[model samples]
Target: MKKWCDNAALLTLHGNTVGMVSKEFVVSAPGKIILHGEHAVVYGKLAVAAALSLRTTLHIKTIHDKDDVLLHLPDIGVEVGWSVPEIAAAVALPVCDPEKPAPPSEELLQKLKTFASIPHDSADTKTLALVSFLYLYCAIVGSQKTLTPLEIRIESKLPVSAGLGSSAAYSVCLAASLLLHKNLISASGKWSEKDLQLINAWAFQAEKVIHGKPSGIDNSVSTYGHAVSFTKGSEPVILSQVPSIRILLVNTKVPRSTKTLVESVKKKYDKSTVVMSAVMDTMEAVAKECLILFEKMYKGKADEYYKQLEELIYINQQQLDIIGVSHIALEKVIQITKANGLCSKLTGAGGGGCAFALIRPDVPKETLDCVIQQLSLEGFDCWETGIGAEGVTLHV
Candidate 1:
């Protein structure tokens, strides 16, 4: 990945001429963790999600003499390019407004599948990623009057396919950079709400390409950072002013299929629709309670707030267990954390991926360190990170 300049600038040469534009800028988006109501969100119930300290970063540099578009994803072992003229010829342009981009056609996607040699049903992350990148690049940039030769490099701090919203962050970063690269969004000033909406809409297109039926929470949180009260078919209520939170995210390193796990939940719902509906409603209520306590906790009462938050966290985990999402590894981690006075819950589509623990502010540093040490000794990866970070901000 290209080294990022924190305070990046627009690079301009002596004079302005046709096909002689070079700009260097950085775009970023945060990965998200669903705090409550993950599976229930699909059933039109409320869910609470927040941006993680972990984020995906995209650095875009324009090159005038470059003959092709250079794409680099060092994290995914993908470094590919296509000559500019050839790509422009092969990619059919569709009418796309930067503010309201359209998804690429099935015909074009099929061609790309063959070009990348990925089967339609294959779960290869890199292949799926390239398909998304190519579609967004072609639809958003190729639709413009003039396309620039640029290099895009992406890197991330979050784990892929472990329910950390890696794909959503990648897509949001791409949409932001492409819009800025096309000069549809300027690098000179602060981005407006309308600009953010456009970025989120474009990112949503990418979500469809990847998840097929995402509930839009990932894209929204990745695009507009911080916490949100999310539900289906309604605008997410953003909690931008929420206080930053500290937690320990531990990875069990056990890969589980999100598709199979989600399908299991659906099957349960199909068998007992009335009972499942009530559980979803209960989950939604819990999420709302968490949101309320979160605000009050931020305002004051550190000790009292932590106790209530911990209770809610435990309750939600039990609910997930009832829905049959918990695995033995996850239960073990929760048990280990609980033994040390901390509370935890599975964070994502949990057959077995990752879970986190709430580190109360009042907890002694020695105790916190001991818990992290114990988790490590048990062969799990742990990181001390914060939540409620800003989303998709330009460097300068």
Candidate 2:
């Protein structure tokens, strides 16, 4: 791989020094869009997800004699650091210091300690996701001499908090970078199924820091970098070997909290068995349809495959609407897209995140443009993305 030199050594942004670099690794994780299973995935139903082109990259470099780790989050203007030993100790320590206000548990403290070791006084724009990665790095690789107070730089192509699983991509990239730094995965070799599983496991564990209770789809897709049939609390089932198909990711700047959405689902689930069962059934059907569509398309029947997929997409959106997760922006996009007979649906945890529109090959450019214009008029942020592009990769 070619090295990308930013020429930062000659131009220090804030008096931060660059040391003799031992090695640097670059890793990427794919962004994701959910077709259905917003609240249903938690109950053991399948969700159809595709990997988006947007990704997050982590640049990890080792430095000499620098007890201080530096994090240069240029995208978020965060530069901070802490001593290596101190951070490890912090993670090992319990939160309750007895003298302090309820010390953190030994496990939780250990994770926080590793996070504080990040090279920055304040967390960056992607701090939560980075912290999750740090915890995983310390756990799997151990805080040995091989890992030291280092500088990490992050760049993300995905929009943060836009329902594109940006945090998942960040965590997955961080885990991949740390593992590569430890030489767990060969730089030039292909990763085996076991290697992918290990990476996914580590990434999922790390995701806890960003999301209190992640369903694993975000990390799984980001780690595997392909469309898969993901069921909560179950192993991911790879949908195809050919990778995901192309789609449009329309982001609604309106932010939605995953915790809130999850809680909402839980509340409704406990209140109405009928509603919950219906939502889960819809999700299961959507998942099956997506799988069938993939199979049909793989067999060289593109038109029929798209037709089925579009119908499924519409049905999935209707389910989301029934579940009260769909936002006005997402619904508007769906209406506009469907008005032109296009396939579109909410992609992630609804309630104002992002949506996806499956485009037919024969659809006229004018129709697509009209759909986009209508969405734009409704204040939706939309863009085209290739599916199943690439999973996590290291850059040196």
Best by lDDT: 1
What range of 10 consecutive residues in model 1 has the weakest lDDT sum?
A: 11-20
- What overall lDDT goes with each candidate model? 0.81, 0.67
Taking the tens digit of each residue's C-alpha lDDT, what string does model 1 give over 1-396?
Answer: 333334434422212455333367667889998899888888988899999999898888766666777888888777887666766666665446656777767878777676556697766666787878777887778776445677888999988777888999999999888887776664542678888888898899888777677778889999899988878899898888666889899888888887798899999999999998888888888898988887886788645777888888999898899999998988988998899899999988898889999988877888888988888887888888888889887765
Q: Which stretches of model 1 miss by more than 4 angstroms?
A: 1-22, 115-123, 270-278, 301-303
Q: Using alpha carbons, what is the TM-score of model 1?
A: 0.90
lDDT of 2 by residue, 1-396 (tens): 122356644212121233222355456778887766666787888877778887787766666666656666555656666566776655543222211122124457345744555443433436665566456645544534333656677778787777777877877776666655555655542677766666777677666666656778788888777677877667777654533566777887888887788788788888998877987897798887777767767677567677777777778777777777888777777778879977787776788888888777787889888878888888877787778667775443
Please identify model 2 stretches exceeding 4 Å from their true place: 1-4, 7-22, 65-67, 85-127, 140-146, 262-272
Candidate 1 pairs with clashing backbones: none
Choose the strongest candidate by TM-score: 1
Report the Cα lDDT for candidate 1.
0.81
- Whole-model alpha-carbon lDDT for candidate 2: 0.67
